[model samples]
Target: MASSFHQFLLLLCCSVWYLTHISQSQSSPLPNALLLPITKDATTLQYVTKILHGTPLVPVNLVVNLGGPLLWTDCSSRFASSSSRSIPSRSIKCSREKAHDLGTKRTTCPSSAQPCEVSTENGITRMATRGELVEDIVAVGSIAGSKATVDQFVFSCAPTFLLNGLASGAKGMMGLGRTPIALPSQISTALGTQQKFTICLSSSDGILVSDQGPHDSVFGPEISRSVTYTPLFSLQEHSIGVKSIKINGNRLSLNASLLSSNGGTKLSTIVPYTTMESTIYATFIKAYIQAAASMNMTRVASVAPFGLCFSSKGIDSKQLSLKVPAIDLVLQSEMVKWRILGRNSMVRVNDEVMCLGFLDGGLNPMTSIVLGGYQLEDIVLQFDLGTSMLGFSPSLLMWERSCSDFKFDSWPKYSL
Candidate 1:
């Protein structure tokens, strides 16, 4: 099975390469010019940027998070006293009006306390304390290179963080949500540009973020177009509208109503970078397993965390390729269909075993789909809050592309 899967992936790659080559010859230039290096730390992807909290600048590693809106960093005494470049913590009176304006769920500022405790919806129990909203310079891309700086940026300075499942090396997270305090909005306001950012994740190389141009430029004739846009359901969580899911070409009789937002349930679809398996409704998983079984795929013993496993020992790569079926995510937009490639769906455990890179998300009533990083491999995702749309395209960069080529300080400059 492993050999067959590998062969299938190779065939798909060849076909895509041929198609991309032909398209590139006829198509215009790509809109994305500024490509910064991204580091893959285990399952999570991080982007490095310099933050000017004080006089001197400090290099901070931040995880690229799209689910939350607030940007914060650990403000422990060790971190603060280690470098003079660290932003100083200040106490400020909490305002009820401001708290109400920002919404209760976001603002953890107590009615009387100077230091605010903020909690994030990272699906974890971690909490971060906010010292005060300080004005600092945030440099994206590189410190010495053609980087964009957002001066007087209002971000929380959390002195401490109780984190789990996150890289300890990371100082904080760069929030890409649509809120006023989000990195995208702050950067857009500072640069006087549209609130837009692009994320390109690959199997080998990590994640790349690029500032997107105007809507006219993006959809115009001047820019080389490789992206397809779909209207975002909500900017708060960067949710996309998924209509249905299919195994190969056959559409499962899954309840579309369960996937829609109603009442207090906000059924969102997010692409998470910290996990390998895409979590879906348990019912959907059953349907998927049935589909695979129909294709003569032999089910093996269940692995921890994953419900489906298959024996791949002694199986020819080409044979596995011919046996496995394709999975397609049908979006709300009829014109767009995201087909899950082989490399994105299967994971090889050992020399003789492989498992589906998808899991049953339980029978929770909440409608949410977390598309894991594995599924997002080699895909470019563009979040455009200005146009209220999400764009996707095949990553132009190859998996074998070295991270050293696009180092933060050595990145090539391009005019916006």
Candidate 2:
């Protein structure tokens, strides 16, 4: 039965992958297929026995065939699959029955009638003791590694609102305002700026903020009652790659560290906001900032106020680690995968990471209509570096463009 179940899952996964990401032609809307969590449990747990965990195990070796007006590196590309390999284990478990349909095996509550919400605040999702993601509710999806670059794997799939009270583990979302999904102007009246204030808003699906204040606040306020502005997903900031440009004759670099896990993680750098690296990275960070300047990207000025702080080698090559701020998520990138090296150790490589960060409405403006707001894809990913191997997500590699195979290429063309 175990062998049959495993084989069934493998086949289901293959079918889902091909149907979602591939087609006879490439012009169709980008595929919405996403990564789901797979839980493996041991037969027993001793009083002092080590807890087992599960890590991302994406064995897909995808070769994207990029061709068209789109820039290969610009978040849209095809994916190829590869052979299967085992990843690390953790203290996650599920019923043997739930493991039967591996491809569609989502974490759900014990009732199986209720759904689970992926906790964006801590980058972790709660599952039934059986280790199942509540079907349809909200649950974080697992990824392959400890550290991930959100920019890489964010632009893969489209998220389903699943009004049936179920939302897919998606990527690329953002928090527009405080809670109401209203514009800054509307919220200002309620909170009264410079005053400690809070308002009520609807609960976020996979694309909005999870109001930590109160679930009943929606019916409490008048001005706050009406959700305004259509909840726009605005552009935050843009930065250029340090390697692509030079500052003070030194290659520029942007280092992001998780500052606090309050609403989400606030990524800050070690350098104060007025350094060279910050200037350079910020200069080229925008999607269309280059086109707006009409200047050779290498020659653009590093004048973005947000790029005030810059650091050279902020993160050491030997070992670089940062904390992920606790914030509600919109969605997570699916292309990236991870392996757990440690489980619940709270130490380097032996930590628990549960979530996938994918590109979403925040970066790809086109997805906003469906996502309905600024979205950031954060899924539950379990990882412990103690007994895991390094894995890579296709999204992490630089995007390439070609009429043929769309592998990572050094030079990808862009149109203004």
Candidate 3:
């Protein structure tokens, strides 16, 4: 009888130990990659993410910008006074050395000036100015999960004009470029990880809740194996080399010399906010039109800004029998080809009209190929600062399943 009781007790103890081990493993910190659900406004292609800033933690929605080097938000009187959780911007002196290091011309400041004025250009044509720089606490990730908070975090308090123009509805912008003042640098230091981060923007329609990962972050270790990496050129610009571009299977006769950044030509791979040079855009449109023509597709009258438009009066974008040619952006190597699908390359302007998304960047004189955000929608972009490499893969959410049916726990199985 005593032996039977001892055996039962041992079995119970072993079961408890197994359960405890499983729980501890489940609670472990997530890998280096942090995945967040990016929210795109219905009217615009810009992607926004949420972050808590300041002492009491005011939730600020910021645009995830890859082309700028400064993290800033609107600090106007209205924004400061409205929220009880809002932390007022404090005054700080701007030194000549500091301005130079920030990649801007040194401005003359008087000794009596409490808030130093500094201005920097954004990814687009907008110029934002900060009247003062202040230190505050910033919390990243979710409040319920493994969150990182940095005390005495420094950022800009932009002028009313800049705030109103650039980030009107949103709080401000979160710059992801390779600058000392960028958000990635600050977050890397706070997390004690290498200065690295990845972005997996889902193009899936509808609202997406945070995934059920252990750390409650995006792009964790489970998805790492699926990423294909390419070397990143120009740290500040985050440009990658493009060997050639092919429409369908035929390659265009492009002048490689004109594409180079040599001499006075400012041509380079830029993740522009919007628009591309007329010359570059024209070439792509011509080839795309040719491909569509071959497919016996009829083109309707051109819209004002869009060079190409198709009548979708009878059929929806998904049901249209149009065979839009696949655009292959051959990167530094022939093996690395980034394919832009028809759904992404074409924009649905209205219920009856679908237009080419590429715009003429004739306004800007500099010869450049700007890869707008629309081209990158629904793609997972991984920026590795430590190795100066950019990795990308199609989002797993591209399957036929609805967004609500996505299971985060089974993400690894769907990785391409």
Candidate 4:
């Protein structure tokens, strides 16, 4: 089953690469980069974004999914747009062939004369419906300055049932996956920009910029000096080559094959934290505890999701961040590690307790390490489709700033 899941994941990502970006863009509506503000739910720790969609421009809250297939929203809302209209299935031919690849439940129109129907699924609950392929307006302020309104912005119109397990007030899911089905590729097709975007996430709210250049001010000195770029594994559930694990600069004794990105590790926004298989999780905990003993990090009763819990008593911490041992995810080489600091490595359960941000993914899970959103907070990630590289900056908090520092009310001079 695990092997099959890996095969399926690889297939999903592989399909994205061969498809053309501008298969559907008849004309350019908005030429500049698109900006979407992201917000994290306090309860779920999941990130969401708000967009002004439809004719009258009602605010639509959508969960940002790294591996989701397409942008889809609940059309059952009372504010369903006046200008929204369903289109024919043959016009764009988007996802028509890949519907079989999904292997999920779907609904389709019985006759060719009827409008196109789509199966919009909830990435969280997996609820699906034969939603309509509708076109409406999407208005947003661009990084190129001034607000722009996109006409005939196409998306799937799902029923209210697909909204289950979403963040409060969220009615849709905005897919940022690697394929043309995602926002970057869709915008690239329409606006003739690079099929790339940078997403900087804070604990609560973050920023998304499509086809944007680097902003040294927004990312600080670390972006130019310490940014690490890794070749992305084509999987929609994106994975990267993790050569080894290091705790406080000490390499852990582990099999190289176990840490392979081929099937062992993947990234996810849905999972609450970076998760490891039971055996690997045990080894990691042992190493962390051994390294932390000198710092007086006393082990306490394990938290429900987290295995390693330490008492906050006598420990130095400010707002759950401490100068703890750094957990490094060594990338292509020993020198190219993605250093995870205290703020990204540990979570404050309470004033009395703190826990490791990683979880255990059972004994024989499909993927060994599923990197989650908690570790991704306050970090800027640039997904470049042209180069097929994932550029990540060192934690923003390292420079005393967070992803929350970005001002979205207007455009800034982001250098190319």
Candidate 5:
């Protein structure tokens, strides 16, 4: 009896050890990887993420600009940081210094008298005054799981007036563009990881993941799955190659030349919904309306910014998704396609109205097709600079998972 009891206890101990080891291994990714939780402002519909910024570390909310020039914050009001004493902007002429960035510039933020000219992906121009330039510690990743810190992180401090059009809580912007000063480049260098970043924006909340790994997430031990790659047209713009678009397996008749042209299709976090040129929008809307009618979906009066709206009476509450037709963005070849199902293709404007989530950018839009944030939610996208490729996955909802389900969290309190 004594021998048998000892044997049972040993087996339980070994089992406990094995379980603990497995948990640790699954939570920690190979080499380096950090996840930053992001949020979407209901009023603005823009995705923003938080970070521990400055000395004495205060929470700062920043708008994620996938192609913006640099990471900037508004330090105009009630901005108190012991580390904000160093002045680097004017000495480095940051406004004129577009390319060269050391990634570690200690400085103080002084109010600027001049407002800098800033441009958006949608071809809108805005005036922004450059504030102070400072380098301090910035933390990313979840406090619960894992966190990575940059010892000497640098970012610009701008005036509060620049926060006019940003998400409700966002003070400024965090750039992930070609500039060396952007978050991707700085984090890539600081962590000694790959020169890439992955984005998985969810509705109201999301994540900004950097470095490389098949990260263990709430979706299981693999955050990277069902991923398909298409060559990136440009890193600066995060542009991708598109052969064509199909509505419910039926191809929309469009100018093939437009798909292969210079400014063909772009991925944007700025715009709320996908925007197309006048010709493309008209063609897409016509095909979608026809497809809806065939499905017996009710068409209601058009809403502002949305040319097509439908009644929720058409939606079958059961069986998961709406009966709407799927959209396929054929990329690289016919085999590789990004599928847009009901969750991504439709937006509930109200209890009675369900609007087709797309926009028309008048006649001459900068890029022919600007894929916006709404469609980007519940999908995983990797902007891999290492291979000049744009990797994407189909809707996560198909697996009964959301990108929001991925492991991520943040510090609760923040200032400005």
Candidate 6:
């Protein structure tokens, strides 16, 4: 019976040792491939292949040659960098909180006959102006003539960088034969990876002779009336495990499959946004410019030459011939709906409604239009004659388009 008890005790001790070894193996991090080579150099340190699963392991202490057990620590614990990133930047003034804070007295505003003097220099002084003040407001309207057309092209990244490194590929065609558009990097960065983007053409798709050379280089058959946008790069969203790509003005989230490339996983996915007709219009502005010029030749009632004065001071008046481009814009037939939201006491129209008004030609030489008594919810005004306009909301005069319906025949041209 004593001999049996001794054998049981010995077995129990062996079992305890085995269990303790197994528990330690489960708790400890996996060692590096070369850590236990059994012939490691005395001065070499063992490096782990993977990070431990729990909180960062406490840094081991090392001794200095001149000191007795000099202390060393991993700064990764106390001074580790964080993932949070924020930058102060100028964003669109869309928030109402910012607008209301700009305190301007109501009584000091303009009356009917006399234009109000606004505080210009320091908000203490004022400058009197004619008519009323205008504010920036956006609305959907039909475009006609050359303005209705747009050109779309995927510019090579090389040309894009040469013109302006900061500008996205959208503005690649701008300033081809003209002074280059001075695009700073800030503008490009502000357009954070756009899923898509749109660029407005300042020129038409036609041949013209300037001091430089032939303008025909910018025109092509592939140029369509719809807006053009190109995708550049992509990023992976950690939360969704999905990849996203930036095109001109849109973003496309996509699911991707990982495949092995060079023995490593290569993540690949399809682009979200595709070039479609309904989403884009490809046309040149020159087509409309020619149409408008042709209409002007037939519709002009009288031709008049007048002397334009440079200034009220020393400059002499120069004789200039001006042709007024007039069109019998179908008022009832060509009307677009204008919806405006009012504030304080400015609401004029309710909800969305049709605004049946003709766009008349303005006296400006370049291009201008006059809208007669057209009322939207946020905008209402009567016009006499001038370029600057005002709105009922914030009292500031602004130079804005008076016409909407833009028509186009074909795609416009552009150069890079």
Which candidate number would show the highest lDDT if scored against the true structure?
4
lDDT of each prediction vs. the true structure? 0.54, 0.19, 0.57, 0.74, 0.73, 0.18
Ranking by lDDT: 4, 5, 3, 1, 2, 6
Ranking by TM-score: 4, 5, 3, 1, 2, 6
Among these predictions, the greatest TM-score belongs to 4
TM-score of each candidate?
Answer: 0.71, 0.17, 0.75, 0.83, 0.81, 0.12
Cα lDDT over the full model 3: 0.57
Q: Candidate 1 residues 1-416, lDDT tens each?
A: 99999999999999999999866644432334333455555544333332434335556665556655766665553234222232232333223212312433543433433333333433233344334454566555531345555666666565444434455576666666667777777777777767777665554454345555332222233222556777776546666666877887778676666655431122111333212112345555677688777867777897776667877754444334345667777786656877665556767777777778776544553435666656665566777788888787633332323222333334434311
RMSD (Cα, Å) for all candidates, in order, is 12.8, 25.9, 7.3, 13.3, 6.6, 33.6
Q: What lDDT tens digits, residue by residue, belong to model 2 across residues 366-400? A: 11112111111121111111122111111111122
CA error at residue 80 for candidate 1, angstroms: 4.9
Off by over 4 Å in 1: 1-36, 43-53, 77-131, 142-144, 212-226, 262-280, 313-323, 365-367, 394-409, 412-416
Per-residue lDDT tens digits of candidate 5, residues 1-416? 99999999999999999999878766654434566778888887777787877667778788887877677787666458776544443444444434443332335553454322223221112564534565667877643455678877767766667777776667788878766667887888887888887888888667777746554433453446678888887646678877899988999998898766657788888888999888888999999999999988999998888899999885952321559978998988899998888888888888888898899977877788988989899888878887888888778877777877755344333411
User: Candidate 6: lDDT over CA atoms?
Assistant: 0.18
For model 2, the superposed segments whose C-alpha errors exceed 4 Å read 1-249, 253-403, 406-416
Model 4 bad stretches (over 4 Å): 1-32, 90-101, 104-110, 128-130, 220-222, 261-264, 319-322, 408-416
Q: What's the TM for model 1?
A: 0.71
- Find the 10 residues in a row with the least total lDDT in model 4: 22-31
Task: Count clashing residue pairs per candidate.
Answer: 7, 90, 3, 1, 6, 39
lDDT score of residue 44 within candidate 5: 77
Model 6: lowest-lDDT 10 consecutive positions: 32-41
